[model samples]
Target: MPEGQVITVTGPRPVSALGVVDAHDHLLIDSPGMPGQGFADVALSTVEARDGVASGITTLVEMTPIGLGRNPAGLRAISKHSGLAIIAASGFHRDAHYPAGSWVYDAPVELLRDRIVTDLTRGMHPADWHDPSLPLDEARAGAIKGGASYHHISHAERRRLEAIGAASAATGAAVLVHTEIGTAAHEIVDLLEAAGATTDRIALAHLDRNPDWELHAEVAARGVTLEYDTIGRTKYHPDSVVLDLIERVAAAGHLDRIVLGLDLGARSYLRAYDGGPGMRYLMTAFVPRLRRRLGDDAVARILIANPARLYAMPVAGGAASPG
Candidate 1:
C-alpha cells in the first residue's frame, strides 16, 4: 500500500509499528516431513502467540509455505486474538514436503508464480490452492517462501524458486528461502538474482545451522540478509556458537544484515503444548544474554531495525495491490 509497510495477515502495517519481531516462526503448520508434530488449533496457537507478545514480541513472520498446511484464516484469527502482527508466507517449500504427483511437483513455472502472486495481491487460498474454486481468504501473505534440498536444488525446487523470484519481482515482497542446514547459500542467491529478485529482497533462513562465520560473512557481503533462527536448538549447537558467529559477522561490517528468530515450527516447541524453550525463549532467555554481550543499540538493531528493513515491502511501480 505504502512504502515502508509490511502486509500482515490482517492488513498492511508500517514497519516502525512492528516491535521486537521474531523474523522466522510458525503459527500453524502440518507437513509430512514431520509426522504428528503439526499444530492447528486456533485457540492453542493464540495462547502461544500471547506468550510471544508477553515476552516482548510484537510481530511474528509465520514461515509456513504453501502445501504445508498454511491456515490463512486461522492465522488471521490468531492475530486478532493474540494482538500480534502476523505476516504469512506464500510460495513453496522444498519438494520433500509435497507428496509425489502432487500438483506442486508437476505444476509449471507460470502456474506456481500465479499462485504466489495471487496470495500476495488478492488473498491466500483458504485451502492453499487444493481447490481453486474455493474463495480466497482476506489474509494476504506478506512474503514469499522457497526452499532448497540439503546442499542441492532439485528440478522441482528450482522451479519453485524461480516462481518465488518472479512473484517477488512482481510484488516487491521480501523472500525467505529455507536453506537445508544452511547449505547452498550462494547457489540460492545466484538463482533468485538471475530470476530477477534482488539480493536485498532475499533472506536465507536457518543459516545458523551451518554456523560458518566465513561463509556467512561472504554471503552478507553480497547484500543478502542472513537469518539465524536456531536460537534454542541445543542439538545443533549451544547459543554461544550463534552469538560468536553474530559477533564475528558484525565485526566484518555486516551487522545490519543480521536478524534473529526462535523458529519454533512444531507443536512440541510451544509452551502451550508443554514444550521447552517456547516462543518466549527468544526474549526471556536469549535476548537478555544477547544484550549483555552486545549493547542495547546492537540488540535493538537485531531485534528491531534489521527485521523492519528486511521485511518491508518495496514500492514497485507496477506492484499488485494488497487486496
Candidate 2:
C-alpha cells in the first residue's frame, strides 16, 4: 500500500481499512499569528500521520478547525495528503478562540445555532486559521463538535453549549463536549436532553478526568457513550488515575459503555514538554498494557467494538460476536 493513500474498506464485512478510528485528534490546531500547524506539512509531516494510519488508525476525526481558528483549505489539503478518511468538525470553542470582541462571542444563540446547523448540513472548508475563500458544504464535515477546553464559566461558554444543543437537535449530528471543570459532562447531558437531543447522539468526552465511577455509570445509563479517552495518560494526569478509572469502569460490568482515544493535538509538545505523552502512546503503551491486563477480547471490545458503536461506524468489519 502506498503511503498517505486511502484504501477502500473492502473486507468481507461492511467495513474496511484497519480496525481503529481515532475519535479525537487535532491534526491542525493553533492560535492566531502562529501560522497554524496543519498546513505546515513539514511541521508534523503527513508522512508521520500516514505512519500512524499504517499502525491501525483507519480513520481520524480532526476537531480543531472551526472554533480554534482552523482553516478549511488546510484541512482539505491535509485530508487529501493523508489519504485517510479524515472526518472534520464544525463548531465553536471557548472564549480564547472567540476572544472578547470577536463576532462569535456576541452572536445570538440562534445565529450560532444556524452556523453549526449549516455546517453540519453543508460542509466546511478547513484550510488554515484565517484562510479566505473556503467552501461550506456537506462533503467536508461528517459531524459537528461543540465544546472546547474546560476553562472559564462565562455566558459565552454557556451560549456555545446551547448552540451545540440546538445544532444537535436540528441536524442529528453527533456532539463531542470538552467537559468544563466537573460540571460540563453532566450539565451538557441535561441541556441536550432538555433540548431533546438523544443520548446516543452525544458523547461525554474526558469522563476520566472527574474519576467518579458512579457518575460515569450514570452517564452511560443515559445511552450516551462515555469516551474513556485518557490514552495519553502521562499528560495532564497520572497514570494511576487512568488505570484506576479503566479498572473501575470495567469492574462495574460496564466495559461495553466506553470508547477509547488518545486526545492528541498538533500543538501538544510531548517530546519538548515533560507533562504529556505523545500521540503514539495509545497504539504503543496503552494497547499492549490493556491486552496484558484484560485479555485480547476485552481489549478488542474497548478499542474496536465500542468505538464503532459509539461513532455509528459499521460494526460488521471483521466479526459480529457481541462483546
- Number of the predicted model whose lDDT against the real structure is largest: 1
Looking at candidate 1, what is the lDDT of residue 253? 92
Tens digit of per-residue lDDT, candidate 2, span 1-323: 11121112111212233367677766656644234432333335355456556556766666664656555555555556766566667676656555456677777888777666655444454442134355553243445566645644467777877887777666555677767543567677787677657787788777777778988887887787777676665545775677678778888877887777666654443332232455556677677777777788887777766655555422222122211
Model 2 lowest lDDT segment of ten: 1-10
lDDT of 1 at 37: 90
Number of the predicted model whose TM-score against the real structure is largest:
1
Give the per-residue lDDT digits (tens) of candidate 1, residues 1-323.
Answer: 12478889988888888988899999899986788999989999899999999999999999999888989999999999999999999989997788887899888998999999999988899987999999999888899999999999999999999989988888888899999999999999999998889998999999999999999999999999999999999888999999899999999999999999888888889999888689999998898888888899999999899988888887632247432
Kindly give the number of clashing pairs for every candidate: 0, 15
Report lDDT per candidate.
0.90, 0.60
- The lowest-lDDT stretch of 10 consecutive residues in candidate 1 is 314-323
lDDT of 1: 0.90
Q: TM-scores, in order shown?
A: 0.97, 0.79
Q: Model 1: which residue pairs collide?
A: none
